[model samples]
Target chain A: MARQTHTPSTGKLPGVEKCPTGIRGLDEITDGGLPRGRPTLVCGGAGSGKTLLAMEFIVRGIRDYGEPGVFVAFEETADELSRNVSSLGFDLDKLVRRRQLAVDHIRVERSEMEETGEYDLEGLFIRLGTMIDQIGAQRIAIDTVEVLFAGLLNEAILRAELRRLLRWLKDKGVTTIITGEQGEKTLTRHGLEEYVSDCVIFLDHRIVNQIATRRLRVVKYRGSSHGTNEYPTMIDQHGLSVLPISSLGLDYGASTEHVSSGVDRLDAMLGGGGYYRGSSILVSGTAGTGKTSLAAAFIDAACRRGERCLYLVLEEAPAQIIRNMASIGFDLGRWVDKGSLRFHGVRSTLYGLEQHLVTLHKLVSEFHPPTVAVDPITNLMVVGETAEVKSTLTRMIDFLKNQGITALFTSLTEGGGPAEQTEVGVSSLMDTWLLLRNVEMGAERNRLMFILKSRGMAHSNQVREFRLSDQGIQLRDVYVGPSAVLTGAARLVQEARDKAQAVSERESMARRRRELQQEQALTRAQFEALHLKTAALDEELHTLEAEDQTRRVTAAGEQAELARAQGADGNGGLSKKGAKRPADRYARA
Target chain B: MIAKHATSDTELLEEAARKAKHQKYVLRLYVAGMTPRSREALRTVSEICREELAGRCDLEVIDLYKQPTLAHREQIVAVPTLIKKLPLPLRRFIGSMVDKEKLLVGLDLIPRTP
Candidate 1:
């Protein structure tokens, strides 16, 4: 590839000053644009943008290089042609006033007009030649020379006349653009214009699948190199911009500045903090495994550095990623508004991979971003051939490296959970390989983000558990549970079961403590009741003793009197009313 | 481009007068077939020769289709083949007589500025 690079051989080349195509990818296709100062013919249908293209070429030459131009229309008047191309942003009038452009409308009326038998188109040639010299034109466009065929009734004279006109144009050294309406049967009316021009370009406006598409194909470029693929082009107020699908090798010199991947621990693993700038890093993982999250972390880090970043999301839309990343504390939208970041979400099936690459390259070139992130490069396999995708990636990686810009590409591993094989198959070309896998240790499953390879620096291979929380991606080293990969649905299920068991064990322990307290309270209540009964009996005995003392004196006198009453009562026993507890003993005796 | 109309003898005579005056070119409508289109081509060619090329170009009328021997003599393979004979490098144009403007352009008759 290096040997094939375009060597500078100025003198060997006939025409070198490139005519800026004013269309994307067009210059690259034409090997640095058109022949600088030679006539090229563009012929197509009435609405095939011939006039528009011609107008754009002339207008651009006037505006960009200060090279004036002349537009000679043999069909429509100058005003009509200018008005027709107004929507495409071609202002011929202003350029004319600036003495940078000249428009000529050749009107031929056969009625009441007489032509001498011997004649030549010397008059029209002189008119155009004067304008070219007056404006000092570097570009000239003549629309529909076939109109001459229409106005001239004698075919023999018209042919010789046209041949003369073309020769004159060539001798003038004005890089000319000759337009003709395409005939249904031939490329041109006389079918001989192709033999007279240096280059031929075909513009196609086709509707496929209900979508209008404008494409450009170079049928021929005499004595020069050109692309063969049908390139997609867009027509808007700015005229035509061809998509540069062929510039896969646009950039090559890359910088070596390192930036962290937003995870402090991961950064630490990456030799005291991050991957090298302009380096291609591949994050390979399976479904439900945090490949996108890790790539986001890298992108977020670049944004943190105030570096402009572009994210090409081939899998998910910007809105969806922004929403899902909210849990991980990464707000890409804010970075987008700050002008530090931009996210372009494109469908993998929308266009061929080369077109996608060209679009991305154009964006990167135009924006001059310091960092770029392509989420899941593997997704492109759905649209293009595998080999083509790989080549495109290689070219792109080369381009990024040459520019010295940091680039991270995420690739999804094949199904059956994160394995070594991936979809897009670009793992070998990457400068760094960041592998995330499920590791199970103990009863816990953990998903860990690890750097498997960093080409120029020391990197840690420790499988650290990566978690996406409200505060963003966090790595927890203290989780000493089972190390099973816990980044999937199955991990969540097992985790819930483990937590449930822990809660149930605590519930039973609380119930056992409640039962022991109930039994101890019952035994204490019985002992207290017995003590109270004994104290009450003691109090009763003291009261009885006091009563006995008070009645002692009265009893002696009563006993003398009672002796005579007792003898009358006969058999007077101890009164039961005055007996105490001790009387139970006496009764038993 | 409208089809050319028929020519009058006076117009033809007048065209001859012009061809004699200046170093202008002389033209002739040499056509084949008896169809109206062929007749139209012959008549239209003479009329134009009278108006534009009169007193300048000599106008000759040749019917090759009616006289196959003449067509063979001229080596005319296709009908409606207009030939410029007086010029050094004689040229021929072949097509239906439908395009008038094309005819003038082909003949190198239109006034050019360059």
Candidate 2:
């Protein structure tokens, strides 16, 4: 696989030089371009864009690479070819008028002519020579060379002339493209052209899942290496663009610069200012879950920073988007009016997957936007198969990242879980995946946004309630409770109930504190009253004791006076009575 | 009477004469290499052109080996095939012209019996 994907420079090869096709994906797969100065055959079934591819190669040769081209159209008229490619934004008429391009439509009506004997393609050679010389053409396209078989009656002469013509084209030293119709068992209706050409590219238009996808593959490249895989191709206003889905070899540079998501909290949720610049961000959600809102926020942030943004509106009109976003204060119209934002709204069912990719590539290049937002990329699944959608998105993301353009894509999932409703399973390719869900907890469904994955960066793991209010998209705090993440009216009700309960609890606590204060004041007054009662009782007891002591003393004093009178006759008896009274008092005390 | 003459006037007769002149047989025979089938087909077709139409037939023989482009252009899936290219409806016949009766019927030579 590594050897197959490796494409060496053709210039380094000995005798082969490659001229860049100047087409989007063809040059990449061709390892620069078609083998220079060699005829490359492009064969396909009818209406498989063979002639268109041939004409585009010539026009691009002249327009992009400054290489003059001569187109020898064998199937369609020059005027018809010019008109056909005009839709691809290739003004072949103008190029012809400028003499940088020459288209010679060969008419081969078998019924109108008579085949004579012994004639070569000298007439054709002369005409081609004159045209090539006139414009000094470096590239030439022979569209449907098999027409010679129909117009000319002699197979022997026609085969001989065709070989000479191919040799002559090679001799002219001009890179050439020869187109042929697909045959039943042969690569081309006329199998000889493939043998004459150096490279063979086959184009296939097939319907898968009812969606048409055109693919191109390099059947054989003579000397140089090329990707042999079938690359999806698209023709639109910008001509042919081949999408090499698996051709990228993981060599793109990563940008460290970050881009804001506009909503500051959402930016914070991404753990950085926003997503990394040039990273692919996926915002997948159910209907009305603010997927578009988040994408718009990213675009709005990009536009605010004076960077250009391209918004591919697949589901809604620009005015509808503007009006819807206006309700959320996004005001995308201003950015559009200022030329910082561009909206390309197309019905998803209008074109096949290839045409859409081509038009998208053209628009992106023309706008040269620094950021691109595809709203509801899931709608593309309606026009393309799941595998095609995945590959197309993968290629587009790769293209955008290579250009250093920050890309944000929003996908709409069904009513199942995020994993169940993944439309194309492109989340694995994304640098960051944001899953939005409608958390249906109660009668109401709330928007819950989850960062499913964010590669190469630290991102928030919390589920945030995404709100689209009059102030635009805001990432509100998640109502994380016993029941987990809650959102919308349920979250609002739960929050309001919690707030009421807190208020009641605080009021009860204050009331309890006041009751305890009142109880303490009552106890202090009771203690003071009891103390006063005790003091009064003590005072009364003291008075009674003093009265009793004074009575005893007076009685003792009268006895002492009698004893003293008697002691006049007997002093010793009086002295003994005082001593005995003193001893009795001491013993009583 | 005048209207009838106007419908079949000199111009109408001239157109009829031109159509008669254009009634010459235009035939093409496809062959692959110098195979016995290819030589036999060429000889039979040439003999038919010479014997049946004589001066009023134009026949061209194409060998697939020499000019595969013309063979493919004519969409010749099989060799030794004959194609009547002119005189109204185009017709094709496979195999050598050994069955002259079928070849005559295919070429509308019986119409020239008069």
- The local lDDT score (0 to 100) that residue A394 gets in candidate 2 is 79
Off by over 4 Å in 1: A1-33, A42-52, A73-88, A104-127, A130-134, A143-162, A179-251, A314-317, A346-355, A376-379, A382-391, A413-418, A436-448, A476-589, B1-114
Candidate 2 wrongly placed segments (more than 4 Å): A1-15, A59-69, A78-103, A112-123, A126-137, A244-247, A417-421, A456-458, A478-500, A529-589, B1-114
Per-residue C-alpha lDDT of model 2 across residues B1-114, encoded as one tens digit per residue: 998888789778778656755479888877666666667677777887888778889898876556655643464533466778887677766565666766776676644344
Interface RMSD of 1: 16.1
Q: Candidates' lDDT values, in order?
A: 0.69, 0.79
Cα deviation at A490, candidate 1, in Å, is 9.8
Candidate 2 per-residue lDDT over residues A1-589, each given as its tens digit: 1221133434454645788988888998988999877789998888888888888888888878999999988777778887887777888888989999988877655653433223445446656777788789889998888888886676787787788788777777788899889998988887855456579999998876666778899998888788998887886656678876643777778998889989898788888678999899999988888988888888888888999999999999999999888888888999999999999999888777776777777788789998999888888888876887887877887888888888999988887554534687888778989988887777877788888888888899988888889988878888889966677777788999999999999999999999998888888889889999999999988886787677668766776687776766664666567656755674465
Q: Estimate each model's TM-score.
A: 0.58, 0.74
Q: What TM-score does model 2 score on chain A?
A: 0.83
Per-residue lDDT of A267 in model 1: 76
Return the top candidate by lDDT: 2
Task: Give the DockQ (2 decimals) of all models.
Answer: 0.03, 0.05
The CA lDDT at A44 in model 1 is: 72
